[model samples]
Target: MYLEKLSLTNFKNYEDGRYVFGRQINVIVGPNGSGKTNLLDAVYFLALSKSAFQNQDAFSILHGADYFIIDGIFEENEHSGHPNRVNPDRVQITISLQRGQRKVIMADKKPYERISEHIGRFPVVLIAPNDTDLVREHSEDRRHFFDGVLSQLDPNYLRDFLMYQQVLKQRNSLLKLFAERNQVDNDMLDTYDVPLLDLGQKIHDRRKQFVEEFLPGFREHYAYLSNESEMVNIVYESEVSDPNFAEEFRHFRRRDTILQRTTMGVHKDDYSFLIGGVYGEAVPLKKFGSQGQQKTFVIALKLAQFDTLEAEKGVKPILLLDDIFDKLDDRRISKLIQQMEEGAFGQLFITDARPERTRELLSSVKADVRFYETGV
Candidate 1:
């Protein structure tokens, strides 16, 4: 699926702008704070119904604006029985979000009940300069990375994930109450853990499967991009701590009652990607490695994500890059742009401050590159 057109009003810094996207690649160039990232965020918000940077919807609206609208037009792929068939009637999805509060989603200009159905319909992978945090930060960061990546491929994972988070919140709140009272909340525990276990297992299994499939691409991407023979690893750390789900569920029974938290399940699962030399002197990439390695790591991970997503979802993902040229050196930038030319990316939205620099780096890629500068 590809977004044929995008229109926004009072969204972020764009007061009123319409972008005609290319099926292969689209580049948006502007100076800092000129709404380059905002353009990309508009596409992401349309596809996923969430901010690209995890920002709240309220913050997405232009300051002092009461409401904002994001409109997207989608066309199904040629492979889907009808090749190159644009819906005679455009499919319009719009979201009218009030400042920091109310939300209403429209599908073909009508209300949408299930948000997950809208996700893979126009799946996109957004890579910013800060994507390196997936590797450099703590396990929670990696877990979020894992969750974000898997959710696009598996709707079941997304649904169960929401359920798990909701139950976890209720359980935690109950735990806090129990601690205050010095007593067990048996009723709360029953309500929370029962559903938590059912949904959490589905989430955990899907994550385990995703990482297994994801690791190969990650290792390959890291090796090629970093130009190292060093080993890379992806492990799913789960708090289940038992062979049988039932056994583990029983093992935590007393604690669940006392603490009022599920305490075991996908909520505690995390991802760990280790990068070091092969059993010799471990060269820390974050510490000793040059900026090139860091840039390559982010690019490679972004590419690997696209590859892994193809297998899981049976669809190519849109690549949304935010100011990547500023973050990458010539070699890494050229290599990435080269891959996009080879069709590694189906459709890409890249932003850069210097149009000339972005053009030169992507020149050899033979893309339909458009150059733009910040306007007063």
Candidate 2:
């Protein structure tokens, strides 16, 4: 699949915009606050039905724009290694926001119900400047990022993921209510627990399997990036310390009553970063690594995520690099650009203000790179 064109209406910084995209490469370049990030956000919103930068739909709309819409024309390939089949003409999405109105998503100009169908079909892997937050911040963020990427590839995993999250939401809401009234909502408790245990267990199992298979590929990229054999840690921290989730549930029942919340299960699960934990290293990457090492490893993780998704889905995901070159120096930037030029990606979109910086790094590579100015 490929993006033929991108159309936007009343989106951030672009009241109306249309751009024909390169089948393999699209570069949006301009000075600071020139809608570079907003353009990337448009692509992301088209693919995921939400902004990659914000948690709220209102935040994605332009300050004064009443509504926003994005449209993309995708061409499908009917011929593959296997026998040929009919291809989808196109899949278009429209995201809208109006005052006192709820956001609605339409597919092919029609109301889209099962949005998940669009996920892996038009997959994407994004690397923003702030992605280092995966290492610098809490473990929960890392877990969510990796799991979300994996879920986008496997619908069964996604089912388990969403089920656990829904159960967690209902459970937390019940706990909040109980805390307010100082009474156990036993009905609410039962309502979420039965499915919670099942879904949580599946989620844990899927994560465990995903990490085990993904670590090698991720580590390979890390070594290639930093030339370090520190064996950067990729641990899958399970929510249930023991296999007996049922027993853990009972043990936490008393605490649940006291705190008015179910404390045990996948809801609280997190994956920690520690090299010495398993490899008996001098020190874990997170603890002793320099800024350079951390950034290299994070980029490696994103690449590995792309590989894992491609291997599982048999389709290379569209890559989005949000100012990834800003943090790295000349040498590192050159090496990374070399890899990217060697067909490390299929379709890519990158944003940055420094055209000279991008030029210096990619001087040897001939691509469909173009420079365009954007501003509010």
Query: Which model scores highest in TM-score?
Result: 2
Error of 1 at 282 (Å): 7.6
Model 1 steric clash pairs: 78-83
Q: Mind giving the per-residue lDDT tens digits that candidate 1 earns over 1-376? A: 6788888999988888877777776778766888888788888898888887755778888888899999888766543223355443356789889865767878877787877766665667888988888667776777777787777767788888887898788878877778778887566577876787778777777877777777777778877765664665656778653568756775676676576566667766666544564576555565655556656666666778888776655567888888887887666666676677787777788898888876777777866665434444
- Of candidate 1, the 10-residue stretch with the lowest lDDT total is 79-88
Native-vs-model 2 lDDT?
0.75
- Locate the minimum summed-lDDT window of 10 residues in model 2: 76-85
- Candidate closest to the true structure, highest lDDT: 2
Task: List candidate 2 stretches off by more than 4 Å.
Answer: 79-89, 185-188, 276-282
The TM-score measured for candidate 1 stands at 0.88
TM-score of each candidate structure, all chains considered together: 0.88, 0.91
